[model samples]
Target chain A: MSSTLQSRWWSWGFRSAVMLYFILLIVFPILGIYGYSLSAGLAAFTENITEPLAWKAVLLTVKLAFVSTMINVLIGTMAGWVLIRYRFPGRGLLNSLVDLPFALPTAVAGLMILLLLGPQSVVGQWAEQLGFSILFHQPAIVIAMVFVTFPFVIRAVQPLLEEMDGSEEEAAYTMGATKAKTFVRVILPAMLPGIASGAMLAFSRALAEFGAVVLVAGNIPGKTLIASVYIFGEIESDNITGATAVSVVLLTFSLLILWLVNYLQSRRKGV
Target chain B: MHVEVRGLTKKFGEFPAVNDVHFSIAKGQLIGLLGPSGGGKTSILRMLAGLETPDSGDIVFHGTRVNDLPPQEREIGFVFQNYALFKHMTVQGNIAFGLEVKKWPKNRIKERVAELIELTGLSGFEKRYPHQLSGGQRQRVAFARALAPEPQLLLLDEPFAAIDAKIRQELRAWLREMIDRLGITSIFVTHDQDEAIEVADEIMIINKGNLEQKGSPWDIYKNPETPFVAGFIGESTIVEDVSTLRGFEQAADWPGTKALIRPEYVEIGQANEFRLLSATETGRVRHLHFRGSEWLVEVDVGASRLVTYRSLEKEVLHPGEEIQVLVHRAYLFNDNDSWIMENRLKEDPMPVHI
Candidate 1:
């Protein structure tokens, strides 16, 4: 090639290399799984996708994700509210503690949850006596998921809470809003987008969490087996097709969640 | 409403943002809580608004102690330094927010919001969001929002600080007229002395968390009670020695306390043989400066202090030329009251930081 053409070719070559790396790292595996899911054509798609066990896994995952997301949104809003707007003795320590989930590995987090609610810890014993089976149950999956995804909602919402002009709440108060009413009317509407976006992020993260869920959920087939654990089991049993099918369902759901969150974010930005 | 603050002190960490400040604001007066930056004007405003509580002392509104009441229960209006417009809300919605919080009737809110938009001259801008308006327009929106609900007391924290200076002067005058029309008791906090003078019925000049002086603008300018007030309110130099000019016009009547003079009152060529120990050159072409309708010319004495003179006509003088100067309006005060002296017969020789 001529020198000018050589430079053009080199730039094109670099672009191809980067594209190939993405394909190898992410897109290739996804494509492989998608192909495997569709290998049996319409028959395999119908059979694997709508299997009773597979349906249970999807249902359980959705229920856990939904409940965890709601709880996280509520508690995370309060947590973020405190972290940004209040000055307590351990304010700095509490601020750092919010980032614990991200800093702690999911496996370690799962173990900590297990230890706390595994019928051995004080809380776990009390919980069992109170007629709640926290560990080795569907609630165990939820507890594990909430633990891994707690900070997502708090971290996402806290900055937005901090960015808000505190004067609005004060204005509400000066105009005769009680503390609760001020938060409900003036503060909540403004914080809704952040909370919504954060909850969605947490939901997606919860759906993908495996290490924590596997430890807490004892992998009982019809009772405690979650989507991630289901995928692990299929892979271990050499049923790559089943693993790919389960993953495809999760991938689609997470994408839908993120898209909804992106819509909320865009609306907030437009404000 | 008449408001009295006694021994109001606010400490942020260890630094006292507002010291033991005591000032009673008369009802229906548009007063300015004037101070420089870090002088605790805003802190005092916040405390009065019930957004901040004093570590000691109490605030009494009318006859009732209000420190224990929440801000909403205080029935007071606060306009923040930048106007604090809700960016998400349109002009109409922003104005209506306060009334909505009060849970005012729908019809009343609509009528009130409309009236406010009209009063603030934002008639066609009701649909615009805060970000869509100019700085002055946002200011008007904030004003409209604060006044839409009939508050017993209105507190403005540096309301015009964000606007351009030209707009600020016009707005300051307009604000005074508006507040007077409502006959509302308003305490506006500002660091600009000129803004306070131009806008307030009475101004409370504060410094370093203490109320230095409180009086009408004329009184403050004509007779500043303290050195801080005198220095902050007007443009005049404190000379090292102005002893003989002590009672001034009352010189033969009763020799009052220590001496002082206004720069404008010190007339050049008004008298002769008034002690020319410090004499300097003044030429018709050298020493004149235009001061609006007047010219302020300087005649330097041997001691390096330029006694300033004012005249409507441009009386120019060249440098190194002869000119006679005299003191017409001079202030006499007790030595103990003054933070510093221009001259002294039995002066204590104290250090003064300008």
Candidate 2:
């Protein structure tokens, strides 16, 4: 009986220690930001968020994140399907390379994109000849966001494809479904949950991207300056309330998106 | 449709899953491809359904060569072992998928799906997903979905293998009756001999990627063409030498000394109860197993251990008791040949002094 009581006390101590650490590391900082955003009163918080530059930056962040999420969904779905269904030379190498973007520093990724699409590069010269510019514009911001979040959708989709039964495709074929129809009707629906959850994660990551966007977006007001860069600019200028308010907005949006992804995943498992 | 396969062969890497196997099925006949696991039964069914390509063969359906036809155009319905019902679709939606693919009218598809739901005894499960149903219900849904488009042939790869034993028996009978009513050429693969004997109109025994024999259940049971078929179809014991047994000494002259003796071919009785006492040999009882309606008695006759059944109505015999044993018939076989050999005493039952 004494030994049981000792183990119980040990478990209680361990639980409280981890809980205290989580609160001190994550919960306290987020609550502090929210509290600081409201420290100057509700009117000040509202005025700071509604400032034309701040609002425009948030809108531009959402728009570019949505665009990058769409691009990732298309490319990632194809890459996942090919990787799971086909056999080829260098397949193992290619599969391992998919996680490279996740492993590399986002700032390094931004520098690479800047170098590849800079005005002096071959791609930049070709784009200039076509009467358009890529670097230091919204397109370059989207490219950086795409690079940083490239692995999310593919990683999400690969497991779903692997878990899928091969006989399901054969059943559809025997039922008079063409290859295209089988993919659209049977395979796509099975992969939908993964795609949706991955896209949401990618969108949230893109929204908060600062290291990569700051290098190539030029940080122009009302054009390419995203919400994260704007918050950094406010912090540099000593406007703590403005930066905290914008951070609160991004935090709230990320929380909602994460909740949505969890809900979708739970529903898929339940079915 | 009348189905015929000529020289069908399938290879996986260097291993031959199916090697030069051939068979034909009459229209409306239910054929069971019975074999041990990894014996290419499923490969044959998949080839017929056009799910797997034969390395070199002709799959002729109704006198037309379909070697190049895709599964969608082959007009064959396949039921996988796990059913493979669309998990995301409701029962009604699953049953209507093939019809929709065939471009059936919307109302017609609805009507056919309703009819099949009722036919498969899933009257109120039309809106239920595959995960929400029992294994038997899932199998019925798969059957209904495969039959929705009215294909010419049906191929099932171990249709009842995934269900519980009780439900498996029920589904076997239900499948046989359903196939008979539909009058569609159907072939199902199974490793169970009893299931094949009970459900299939004809049984094709496959072994080592070869078609060993194909016949009706009664014929296959009565006359197994190959040694494998004889050993596989019924319970029997293989003895290395038959010359030591009474009245089976004539079988020693056959090319192979090995012989298969079934329980029914041996007769056991008391010393005074046997009418053919002159032709009988005294043996000691080794063991007895209770087999529901009878006692399976194992006897030690010289060096050979023989098994025979005693009716429950007869007096119980204890182990180590001496009993008169009479040999009637045995299947003598070698690696490539087999034939039944009857006891010489039964042919000429005159009192013979040994």
Candidate 3:
């Protein structure tokens, strides 16, 4: 009876410690950002965010995040499907390479993209000849965002694809469904939850991306400047309130999306 | 449809999974491929369904060679061992999937799904998803889904393998009845001899990627064409060195031959009452087990032990008791492991009637 009581106390102590750690690390910081954002009142907060440059930065970040996440979901899912299903030489090597973005420093990824497409590489030169610039442009920003966010969808979907039995698709084929139809009906439906969650992570990651997008986007105010880079500019100009306001907005949006994903998954479980 | 597999073979990497397997099934005949695991039964079934391409030989359906045909073109219905029902779809939706894929009219698809749901006894589970259904219900949905497409041949890979023990038996009878009612040629692969014998009209024995024998369950049980079949199908004592067998030395020389003696065929009697049996030899009872309806008594026949059954008579047979075991009948296999003869009454002059 004493030993059981001791274990119960230990469990409670561990739970409280974890809750306290999360409260101090995450919840307190978020509350601090909100408090600073509203220090000068809601009118000052609105005026700070209503600046044309900052508002355009927000719009540009949203567009980049959306487009990049859409591309990531399509390409990453296909890559994951091939990696899990097909047997080819170097498949293990290719599967391992999908995590390169996660392992590499985001700034280094940005530099690598710069080296490959920044008016010097062969493809970059060919694009220059075609009268289209890829470096320090919208495409480069999107590309950098995609590079950093590539692994999220693939990592999420790969495990799911591996866990699913191939017999279901085989059954579909024997039942007279074409290969394309089988993929669309049987395989895709099973992969949706993974795809949706992965896309959300990629969107959030792209939304908050700083190092890679700043290097490639050139941070042209009201043009290629994104929300994070705009906040960085605000911090550089000694405007902590402006930066904190934008930070609270991004934080709240990220929290909302995460909560929405969790809600959707729980709703599916309820069904 | 009448299905024929001619010299079909499949190899995985360097190992052959199904080697030169050949068989033909008449139209509307329900056949069972009975074998142990890794015995090529599933490979053969997949080959027939065009799910797995054979390395060599041809698969013909109703006189048309379908060796190069893809699974979708072959129009085969396959029920996976795990059911493989679409988890996201309702039972009705799962059944209608195949019809919808084939571009059947919406109303026709619904009508066909309803018919199949009723046929598979899943009328109340039409709206339930695969996860909501029980194992047996999932199996029925798989069957209904496979059948909804109206394929030429239906193949089931261990249809009753995943259900509970009691439900396994019930589903076996239900599946057999459903197949018979549909009048569609179907073949199911199973590792259980009892399941195959009880459910299939004809049983095909496969071992180590080789087709050992194919016949009715009764014929395979009684007159097994191979020593493997004899040992596999039913309970029997196999004596490889037949020369060591008591009262069989004077028989004709069958080099490398083995003899199979079924338990029920060996009649046991008391040592003093040898006259009650024909062609009798003396042996002591090594062990005795009361099997409720009968006694499974093991007799030490000199070099080896022979297991034989005895009725639960008034005199219960006990261990270490002297008894006379009559070899009423036995099967003999040749050197190449093929059935040579069925040694019946008055067969050899080796042992005399006591």
Candidate 4:
């Protein structure tokens, strides 16, 4: 009986320690930000959010993140399909290279994009000849976002494709469905949940991207400046309330998107 | 439709999954491709369905070569071993998929889907997805979906393999009856000999990428053409020397000394019960096993251990008891050939009541 009581006390101690660590590390900071943002009163928070420059920054961030998510969905879906379905030389090397973005620092990725698309580079010269610059603009911001979030959709989709039964495709073919129809009807639906969840994650990550976007976005207040950069600018100018308010907005949006991803995944499993 | 395969072969890398095999199926006949696992039964069925390409062969459907035809144009319906029901689609939607692909009218597709739902006894499961159904119900849905477009031939690769044993037996009968009613040329792959015997109108035994024999169940069981067939079809024990046993000494002149003796060919009785005591040999009972409906008695007859079934109505025999044993017939075989040999005592003047 004494041994059982001792084990019970030990279990309680471990549980409380984990709970205290989580609250201190994660929950406390987020709540502090939310409380600090509202400490200046709801009117001040609203005024700061509705400021024309701040509103434009948030809008631009959402728009660019959506664009980057779309691009990732297309390229990542194709890459995942090819990697899973085909056999070729250097395939193992290529598969391992997909996770390079996640391993590399975001600042380094930004520098690489800047170098590759800078005015001095061949691609930049070609683009200039076609009448526009790619670096220090919306295109550069998008490129940086794409590079940083390149692995999300592909990593999400590869397992779904791998777990798919080959005989399902063969069954479709034998039932008079053409190859294109089978792919559209059978394969696409199987890949959709993965693509959707991955896209949401990429979008949320792109919205919060500061290291890569700051280097290439030019920080123009009403133009290419995203919400994260605007928050950083507010912090630099000692407007703590403004920075916290903007951070709250992004945090809330990301939380909603994450909840949506969880809901979609659970629904898929339930089905 | 009549189906004929000539010199069909399929290779995976350097391994031949199906090597130079040929067979023909009559219209409306249900053929079972019976074999051990990894014996190329499924490969043959897949080639017939146009799911796999034969390295060098002709797959003639109604006298027309269809080697170049894609699966979509081959007019064959295939049921995978796992049923492969579309998990995302409802039962009605799954059944309507092939019809929609064939460009059937929307109203006609709906009508056909409803008809199949009723036929497969899935009357109220039309809106239920594959995951919501039981294994037997999932199999019925797969069958309904494959038959929706009414193809000329049906190919099933281990159709009942995924179900429970009791349901497997029931589905076997159901599938055989369904194929007979549809009158479509059907071939199913299986490793179960009893299932093949009970359900298939004709059974083709495949082994190691070769078609060993093809015949009706009774003919295949009684007259196995190859040694593999003889050993595979029944519970036969292979003995190295048949001349050492009583009445089978005439096998000494046979080409091969190896012989297969089934439990039914060996008779065990008491001393007074034997009519041909002169031809009988005394052996000690080694063991007895309860086989649900009968007792399986194992006897030690000289150098050979023979197993025979005893009726439940007979008196129980104990182990270590000496009993009179009689050999009626055995299948003598070698690597290249096999033949049936009856006991010489059956031709003797002594009357045997066995």
In the range A17-69, model 4's lDDT, one tens digit per residue, is 99999999999999999999999899999999998988899999999999999
Best DockQ goes to which candidate?
A: 4
* TM-score, prediction 2: 0.95
Model 1 CAPRI quality: acceptable
**Sorted on TM-score, highest at the top, how do the candidates line up?**
4, 2, 3, 1
Best-fitting candidate, measured by TM-score?
A: 4
- In model 4, the runs with Cα more than 4 Å from the true position are A1-11, B350-354
- Taking the candidates in order, what DockQ does each have? 0.49, 0.80, 0.73, 0.86
Number of the candidate with higher DockQ, 2 or 4 = 4
A-chain TM-score per prediction? Answer: 0.89, 0.97, 0.96, 0.97
Clashing pairs in 3: none
Over B14-117, each residue of candidate 4 has an lDDT whose tens digit, in order, gives: 98999899889999999999999999999888888888899998999999999999999998888888998887899998999999999999999999999989
Order of candidate numbers by DockQ, starting with the best: 4, 2, 3, 1
**Comparing candidate 1 with candidate 4, which one achieves the higher lDDT?**
4
| Steric clashes per prediction | 14, 0, 0, 0
Q: Scoring only the second chain, what is candidate 4's TM-score?
A: 0.97
